[model samples]
Target: MAGPNSDPIVSATTAAQLPPGAVVLHVEAGDRQSAEAAFAAGHVEGAVLLVRDEVVTRPMRPGDGRHPLPSAEDLADALGRLGVGWDAPVVAYDRQHGDNAAHVVHLLRLLGQDARLLDGGLAAFTDPVATGPGTTPTAVAREPRPWPADMLPDIDAVAAHAAAGGVLIDARAAERFRGETEPLDPIAGHIPGAVNAFYGDNLTPDGTFRDPEELRARFAALGAGPDAVVYCGSGVTACHDLLAIERAGLGRARLYVGSWSQWCRDASRPRATGPA
Candidate 1:
């Protein structure tokens, strides 16, 4: 299992500091056209664009949130096309902070692959940028494997965790958590009994993640531990908190992928407003 000691985060002042032979990915949270446009403008040398819509997620459905996890076979095929073998070490980054990149890294880690996020993202990367259609290595063969059942919990499991007094963290902005404003989901409040821990708080002002010790302290204040369950509006940004948790040397927390989108769809599952 990958943990904090596995070097789940990396900072590179130059390309030389990046892990040798690692597959570098410029992960974008938007559509393919936008991702390609951004990559074409300029990006880290030898990095390939991994658009969330094209590779990591599937079309949204009624039960699943806005961004659903792709089938194991589909994800394997997408990675294979990018020449990413199961054993290859991967380093993912985005234009700004690593929310999108952390999501990809979280998925990769769950698949038992060695994946890390580039600290501070592109702005902190001092390496020279290369423009135009970047390099595309020859495709490699990959095998499909079931997503590890233990790390991901459905809505029922999340409810049970909350009912049983386990830590349930809502990784949305304070306003959303407090039912003041909701930009995406229809519902404004969070799951009942959930504590608000905005994912952005995991980072420093410059956008790099906080020190592991600091992250440990932050989550501790929220009563979170290894068994904590984390969720966000659509489950995409919640991985930011999970990454921070692991970086804090806390064991990997379970992810409720359905998140607020699915939870809010059913008015039966209780909801709460105001500060947690």
Candidate 2:
């Protein structure tokens, strides 16, 4: 999965202090009322609540999985509407254990934008919370480029990786990875030769990401390196693991964007049950 070497993207370790002029993006996939209720209770100062329907995903198709990515143009439009400039340093947060926020951070990074998930999410906020609606920035119309080609691996690439004995990680729950329980997708197993590294393991009990050295040790157990490929049920939660990998300084890993949902759709693709 290792490709071109690029400059590092700076991140904020805490919610209280961010890169200057950083925009706080609060992404929650729950119902609007509850999300707004949570936002009113206290969101980072000057943070905006990005509506779930508006930016979370696009219409689902048979092979696109439950949470298909929106078009780059549509995403650019949404961000522009929210006043997120192409160069703006963004700190995204969500109450759902950083899954939603990680998704946004992943996409923004894919688009070559400076974005990072607030470590520990909203709970990590040590500053005063602001109530009511979010502040709108002076709209900036910037034409966004297409999604980076190297950001993800397609189905064929994933199969090749597995066949080549490349490191492939399943970020689903251990039970789900073992085919013991699958409450979402129809499939109950993981890709052949894929190791299970439950994304939640990257976080501490309080929900903040574990220390980088600890994370490095955990991924090292799975043989994670620059060539690793990570996936989850439908590719949303997988970003959390990818972010963890980056935070651990483990190098860039490719994402199987369609993930298990897309893989299982084609019965010809090999699927393995139980522990790898």
The root-mean-square deviation over C-alpha atoms between each candidate and the true structure, in angstroms, is 1.2, 3.0
Tens-digit lDDT track for model 1 on 79-184?
Answer: 9999899878899999879888989998898888889999999999887788998887679999988997778898888999999989999998999999999999
**Residue 102's lDDT in candidate 2:** 86
Q: Which residue runs does candidate 1 get wrong by more than 4 Å?
A: none
Q: What lDDT tens digits, residue by residue, belong to model 2 across residues 192-263?
A: 999999999888898878888898798888887768999999888888888777777787677888899989
* Runs in model 2 lying further than 4 Å from the true structure: 1-16, 31-34
Task: Tell me the deviation in Å of residue 94 in model 2.
Answer: 1.0
Clashes of each: 0, 0
TM-score of each: 0.97, 0.90
Query: Which number leads on lDDT?
Result: 1
lDDT of 1: 0.88
